[model samples]
Target: MKRRGVPPALLDAFLVLVALIDTWANVGFDRGAPLGCALLASFALVLRRHLPLTTFLLTLPTALVTDAVFATLVALYTLSSLNRHRVLLGICALTYAVIDFLPWPWSNLRATELAGTRNVVHILYSVASAAAPVFLGQLVQARRELSLRLSEITEARENERLLTAQSVLAKERAQLAREMHDVVSHQVSLIAVQAGALQVGSGDPETKSAAATIRRLSVQTLDELRHMVSVLRASGSRPTELTPQPSLADLQRLVDGSGIEAELKTDLPGDLPPATQRAVYRTVQEALTNVRKHAPGARAIVAIHHMNGTIGLTVTNTAPTQAPLPLPGAHHGLVGLRQRAELLGGSITSGPTSDGGYELHLELPIGTT
Candidate 1:
């Protein structure tokens, strides 16, 4: 409730002091009467923060009964600046009407010899007192509403800026993924092919030693590719090597060493595009890794089926004997994987399976594949 250049509490206290002074000035030497009115007005000021409506109600009666201009001004300002105008307006109108007709001590004084002169002064006093409060209250209320609207507009602009930043980030990551895939695939494939050929055909001991070095180099190159991909995906720095990415043909090997006795059934369509095949391979790789991490000691089943114009893959594992390792602070792994699949016009879902196991299913539409 602080305002520019002045704190709200301090401002309220100053207003209350002004109202008290006005009360004393208006009452004059009424033998403790002015003191009582000033105290009541000041006490009403303290209620401004928590019960502004009640404070306004309390002040309005004092304003109407007393001839204190500053007390009425403080009440009007609190209502308009701190509370809403519609309620303040209705209260002020009713209060003024009641005070105009009331049989007060001052009203009784205007009945006798000096009645004409006293009536003139009273009329002037009523016009100035009533009009000033109403005008100032409306002015303050309008300013408060304008400030609130401006704040709402500022918040909306900030949200738009945040959305724009996220969209730009997603596009940058997509471009990085494209560049890294192109660069690493060619280099790693060339190294693996050259190493395999030299290992089989070479006869010299030196050539044999060179082939072994090439094999180790090829493994290191693949590891480097994974690290670069993880970094680009905004997953954490640490790399976990689990079941390797399997092509359509590696279904048997995936099942054989999954650390659980299992079976794999595949009806993968031949002539699938290279990118689609890679996506499917990555999906299966992640699914198997999840099984090992979260469902250890549970026998699993892997299946890749071609149905209609889409490739569907499912991996299911029974409930594990022990709880899975707590995920290290790398929350972005699954998020990044889903983004990858979506870019290739595919979707993936992984969660607990019915019948006491977990399942992961991925689907890639044929046109995108």
Candidate 2:
């Protein structure tokens, strides 16, 4: 875009006029001196915006006195629009004014005119020079501030875009988890119902044994599926009509149902919230399930401690003699457990113990339900 202020052509024309006037009015062997000075001043003015400091220095001498009015104006405008150092600019202006009026032979003017028309002209020149530089400096500073603000706005928009991307990814993950739960639960529920029916009937030895195995597998799969759904549904509000979760009070039933004997000890606070109790229960449930699947016939230990607005649950089981069976899909139970813990500012840690045993530990803030 074309910039504001005087155009180059107009400025060039003004310089030509000033040069011609200086050369014609003065009678001397060095007739082109004024013309040369005016042209140089105009050239400096034109390039002032790009190199402000140099332009200010270039115009400081002759321009301070006689015919370099345009040059002085240009230097001031350049200094103000570019350099931020006002004190430096002021010092330069004062120096130029002092030198312009000094009673020196090379200066080609006398002290007699110091308070005359010459003085008026010098005063006007000083004011214009200082004012233009200051004005341009303010404009430049405002432009810089505006640029900074624009950069901040752009950064904020980029951050918002990233957050939106993350939230979308989280939702997609939740949807996939929900779909998996549906597929697995449907098959497992059908198997469980059929097995239950068969067990009530024919007592053929093979059929009875096959039915019992089916019932066990089906029940286990259903429980795992339910846990998966619970984890997936962690984002929304708590389920209003959800069945009460088993806590320490029902720890015995959990161990008995899993067919893995759990030696349990509880020092739990009576005032523990339903959510804390439930988290403890689920940790134990998952721990026992892992024991059955990966540590078959191994004894398990469960412990609960409540203190200082925190509830800590631990479950450890001896390792199985056989190799662990690989499970399909992501570990939704652990994912849900972590998500639940994070929601309540809690944590869970699980790993193989030192003596060929596996342990699960969970901590939940009290009154966080």
Q: What C-alpha lDDT do the candidate models reach, one value each?
A: 0.69, 0.71
Candidate 2 lDDT, 1-369, residue by residue in tens: 223798866875675456445434532225365455555655665566577778767666445434445465556665766676878778766666665445444556655666878678878875665565566767887897788898899999999998888778669768877787778788789889999889779689777776876698789778767876776666443552455556668877777667555688888866667777777778788777778777766888888887888888888888676666776646687778878888888999988889989888888888797
Query: Considering every candidate listed, which one attains the maximal lDDT?
Result: 2
Q: For residue 321, give model 2's deviation from the true position in Å.
A: 11
The 10-residue segment of model 2 with minimum total lDDT is 20-29
CA RMSD per model (angstroms): 16.3, 14.8
Query: Could you tell me the lDDT of residue 172 within candidate 2?
Result: 75
lDDT of 2 at 150: 86
lDDT of 1: 0.69
lDDT of 1 by residue, 13-121 (tens): 8887787777767765474754565567667887776776676566655554566646545665556555465765666645654464344555564445345776667
lDDT of 1 at 339: 87
Q: Please tell me which predicted candidate would have the highest TM-score against the true structure.
A: 1
